[model samples]
Target: MTAWETERVAWAYLSRVTQGPSRVVSDFVERYGVVEAVRAIKSGVVPRVVAERVSARAHIDTAAADLDAVAALGGRLVIPTDDEWPAWRLVGFQTGEFGGRADTSVPLALWVIGGRSLLDVTERAVAVVGTRAATAYGEHVAGEISGDMAVDGWTVVSGGAFGIDGVAHRAAMGVGGVTVAVLACGVDRAYPAGHARLLQQITSSGLVVSEYALGTTPAKHRFLARNRLVAAFGEGVVVVEAGWRSGARNTASWARSLGRPVVAVPGPVTSASSAGCHRMIRESEARLVSNARDVVEEIGSALSGDDEQDHLFSRGDDRITGPAILVLDALPGSGSLGPHEISELSGVPMSDVRAALVMLEMESLVVRDDTGWARAQRRR
Candidate 1:
């Protein structure tokens, strides 16, 4: 093997031996570099924390074989040393770690497939995610938002599972827009199996990426680990329909931890599936987003993080539209109502209600809190 190939093999070894979010090992690799770190780990000379994480698998070296396996499938191992390593997108994992999120450790390497360049597509990506046991409303909403985002030149990203993730991927493809799937399993094996064809379609068009080795199968813990990547890659996350304790909620937390804007779609209050999204909105961290336009607005503000406040509230100066006025009047003076309640009270659909809320919030006519939406100090 060439020297570069040898370096990649070392990365493969380190990446395969342990489950990630191993901040100690990540730091060791940072301090000593991949080549030397791999040597020390193998020779049992690494730190106690690193050894505890890797000792079980350290003796088994499948780096060469795994590299060959991915290559045989027409994919490649993308290491940090490579130019297309997604450094810009994944950079937040560093700060994410310091911010006390255990799941935010930078990956040692990745296995990627498909024709599209990973870096190019992730530049403006949004993760559309929710429950596997999704409702028709959830699927419908996911499709509309994903398709619209695609048409607007944003890459739609998801976990490649059933329900919302699958809907998001297919919707993006239906519009011939870029989409990416960050898998918990090996890129070679479709974990849901039903989406084997969907995974293949993604390979033919966008990318299917994983940090695991070529044969890694999906598992409970791995899926949790995978959510961080979905959040990290996307500039924002939009939860369509999530149960109270679903992976979509986990992804939302990761997004919030990464300082990415998180948007939640409120559903019918009676929907058990939408419990998580509603709760997230109630927590006041996630923006209420009902459609693609709302998602773009939230993500646009996030991207322009350094720009003037005027940039985000550019439309704030405009006279409040009819919808905004109606939404304003729907609010109970002292208490709060959620988007759905406001929709019902104002005789407006939740999508329009969300837009009006955005305008109202910017204009200081309304505010949102853990309880939901209420009147602000003054109406603009």
Candidate 2:
């Protein structure tokens, strides 16, 4: 095998033996090289901690079998050196602060099963995650935002579980857009079992990725560890609905730590499912997102090179047209007006006025308050 192939095999073996972060193994690989580390492990000359975890002979055999299985499934082992790897997404984890756990190292390799390249699908990705016991409203919002994001050329990334994650993936796929499902377990094995078909669809058009070896099962701690990968893989993360202690909140924490934008969709205050989202917004940990447009705007701002003032208020005059411009013109300079008021003032139909309001809001030319909508104050 070539050097890359040799490294792939060694990483796969290391993945099987290491339970959690593999910081020690990563350090060993960095110090002595993958080939040398593998040799030392096989010779029982490695650290006591690693030696106790794996019997050299059995572990090596398992690793070989894992590789064979992956090959049989038509999957590829992607290391950092691979051309198709999403290196940019993994950059923040370079310092080993993955999941905000200093002991845990970033994944050394990923088992990717998909037709499209990882980078191709994840170049402009957003993560939509929430509670498994999502309400009807939460699911609806997740679907709408995910579908819209997909249609706008942004891939939706999520854990392959029930509730928000499943809805997000299906919504993205329904629109014939690429979506990635990051798994806590091995990509070959479906953790929920129910999402097997959905995962297959994702792989056919996008990607199913995991850091684990072929047969690793999903454990409670594994899912927590996996959230970091989900957070890191996307440009921003959207939590549709999460209760207190929800795993989605954990993902949000990881996103914040990585300096990636975190957006929370507000739900009814009475609902427990939305408590985490409300807390995030209240604590100023995440920006509030009401629709796909809001999500796009928040993430775009983070990615844009424009100055804050310019990005917030500077839109070309020609960009606003038709009913949108009419509605903007109708708004009072110092006070808010409802959509109905704007419709009457602009001589535009109520339906057109509503549509215009959405467009205007996205452009930051208008602001909505409890009373109504008003023209946004332009930066001097």
Number of the top-ranking candidate, with TM-score as the measure: 1
lDDT of each: 0.83, 0.80
How many residue pairs clash per model? 0, 0
What CA RMSD would you report for each candidate?
14.6, 16.1
Which tens-of-lDDT digit does each residue in 203-298 have in candidate 1?
888999998887788898788889999998898999999998889988988887767889999999999999999999999968899899999999
lDDT of 2 by residue, 1-380 (tens): 88887888887777777644666777677678777888888877888765665554424546667788887877878875566766556545543334436534668788889888886677778999999999999999999999999999999999989999999999999999989999988888987999889898888888999987787899988898789889878888999999987999999988876667899999999999999999999999899999999999998777653543222222234344445655776677699998888887665679978888888888887899999999887665
Off by over 4 Å in 1: 97-99, 306-380
* Per-prediction TM-score to the true structure, in the order listed: 0.79, 0.77
Clashing pairs in 2: none
